[model samples]
Target: MPSDGFRGLVYGDWHFLEETTSKSKDSHVSSNYAYSMGIALRGAHYKVYPELKYDSVKPMLFQKHAAMSINLRNTQPMMLQNVQMKAVITKQGVFSQKRIFSVNNSKIAPNSIVTLPVQWQFDELKPGKYKVQVQVKGENDWNKLPMTWKFIKNIKVDKKAADNINDKIMRKPINKWFYISMATGGLMLISLVELLKLLLTGSK
Candidate 1:
């Protein structure tokens, strides 16, 4: 009642209508109501949280394009709305390119997990440990502040792959500002079977 909170009504087994009070989270009534309220409010920030994991089917990359997957789980009390992700590829700690991927289902129900198949296209990465960083955001009307989570994974490229990418690297780098400004659903995924067919055709 003292803070900017919603008013509550009585809901119980008794027939009489009365205001609701809590001895919540292992507290005794003799200590007064402030103790219980303080504990619950203090833990409010921990109420809404999500889990994220990134994996690559081809961890040891051989060429320009690779297949990876993302596992996202909604472990909170509310439904996650318009859940989306942005992935970036970086070398020497500076990101080279970025792509935004939309979830198949815009609304993720509470306690539900979704696996997104990620197709990465970076023809400029050399033979080294380049980091793939992914950021996920949760959009809901009840979320007053921005909710986001980030995860990173490194991919190794052998000499064969490095040479292939080197031959295809563009002369000028794409401006980072330009990449950020032009946000679009430009990411596309091609199946592994089709990729093999293309490679085999090129060899002929």
Candidate 2:
């Protein structure tokens, strides 16, 4: 249950649909907007929805990389066109940090499901609760109108995992060139000593 805000269509979740007709008149266009309050507006028939599969009830590790597996299903009579999904993750109370994932333009067959590749990083996120908001939108090949659906999942970040990941990230990197240089110097010293011993033996 989502609301359409108060004082607007008062019927809750109902939006007055407006049909606009425009005609060109001498380099200018005149528009006629028609609306009837009593008339029920049959909104765009949504034939597609997203199903995000994961254990959202449990806390998740705040790893460097995380993925939200989702599948888009089309249940319409005709195939869907230009289907795309956008996923957004924002801190519950904080507005500064945000992560976004996008699904490129794709096509879904009628009565079929399309898996989407959605991955996000939590390396920079603080250990707290967040909401993953996903939106799937597409158009029917024959219907001319676009349809959109939305979904949300609540998730919590594990503090222990976050601490471990941050500790690993903050650790200093090892210097491999230092070890290589030391090995080269040791070999050269050994070769010089052997050369000196051979010189003495030859002279004697």
Candidate 3:
């Protein structure tokens, strides 16, 4: 990894983790969602990185992911005036579920970073490149800075790769086995009825 000899190594299988934060109070307030979380100019920050490979088969089914730490100190000497941070996942242009945290009720000094651990499960994610963004909002204003990441749908882990493995989304559907059993029972009942009818007609 020599920076001098190798100017840069551009490869398709590689991606860089990223961090994004609000630049100014105006920028913060301008963000509709971020502004609502209670953010200030200098103390807040967000980081994004690959946590782990979620599964092995159809590896694209899920991915281990998390967000940067959230510190109450971002509000500084002045306690948070209705402040919180939120993280979300999106594909194509649609947003998914969000995880939210609050600092307004806590005591934080200025310039400190607070972190909330996120172990999230994502479904309906196609195999391709996607973006994950975090927006910090203040009750009075919005701080919107976006950090984007590239996800490559390659290999999935063993636990998640198995098609038969039960998933959060898959558990709700009716079982295929149940329907097969029901159909078999109906056929058996019909056959018994036909046999009984034939016996009765013969006796007549």
Candidate 4:
């Protein structure tokens, strides 16, 4: 039996050889015994996949905040416990940011699927291409077997367009007020000019 509570192979054999000179001696025989024990094996398999969503029309364009959904499935027959989830964001293969989330001492039954959602903000990120990677690790209560999963996604950032959208949302009312003020000032100036012309003609 292995440390993972699995048994692989157990073998035993016995062999005996008879002596030729039985008349000279009372009886003589040779015997041999063999035994082999194999190491114990651990069994736990997991399937991990990632899904990404953005507010922009283009899936590749990541603006504002992006939602990362991670799907985990237990493909083995054993239950997995103490699952830990981690996510990392990179810019052109360079390290950018990372986040860690855990499932405590929970157990995921066999053939069961779980979805985890993570939010990433791009407000502070500069305009460029980025890579998002998600990782999941699980261990049994006995701590004998460990399972892991990793996934990656590519995205492009348009800081200029994001800034424009933000500016429009923030200053929409202010722009409307400015336009109204300009139209009113123009009308008042035109009326003053007409009054001044009438006064000049009267004086002449």
Candidate 3, 1-204: lDDT as tens digits: 224332111111233444454567555542222222333322223221111111211222222332223222242222222344443333332542443333333222233344433333332323323334444443211222322222222222243333322343232356899999999999999999999999999999
Task: Count backbone clashes in candidate 3.
Answer: 24
Best by lDDT: 2
* lDDT, candidate 4, 1-204, per-residue tens: 335543222122344445443343554654444454533233442222222222222222223344334556654445556767665555564646553334555555544566554444443334567676666667653333686767767877687754544443322134687899999999999999999999999999
**Which candidate should be chosen as best, given TM-score against the real structure?**
2
Which portions of model 1 show Cα errors greater than 4 Å? 1-66, 91-105, 120-128, 140-145, 155-204
Each model's TM-score? Answer: 0.35, 0.40, 0.27, 0.34
| Per-residue error (Å), model 1, residue 22 | 61
Where is model 4 more than 4 Å wrong at Cα?
1-66, 91-106, 121-129, 141-144, 152-204
**TM-score quality measure for candidate 2:** 0.40
lDDT of 4 at 32: 47
Q: Distance (Å) between predicted and true CA of 105, model 4?
A: 3.8
**Model 2 Cα lDDT, one tens digit per residue, 51-142:** 22332322233233444345555544355568777877776774546767687577555545555434444343367777777777777555
Question: How accurate locally, in lDDT, is each candidate?
Answer: 0.50, 0.56, 0.35, 0.51
- Residue 136, candidate 2: Cα error in Å is 2.0
- Give the Å shift of residue 198 in candidate 3: 4.6
User: How do these models rank on TM-score, best leading?
Assistant: 2, 1, 4, 3
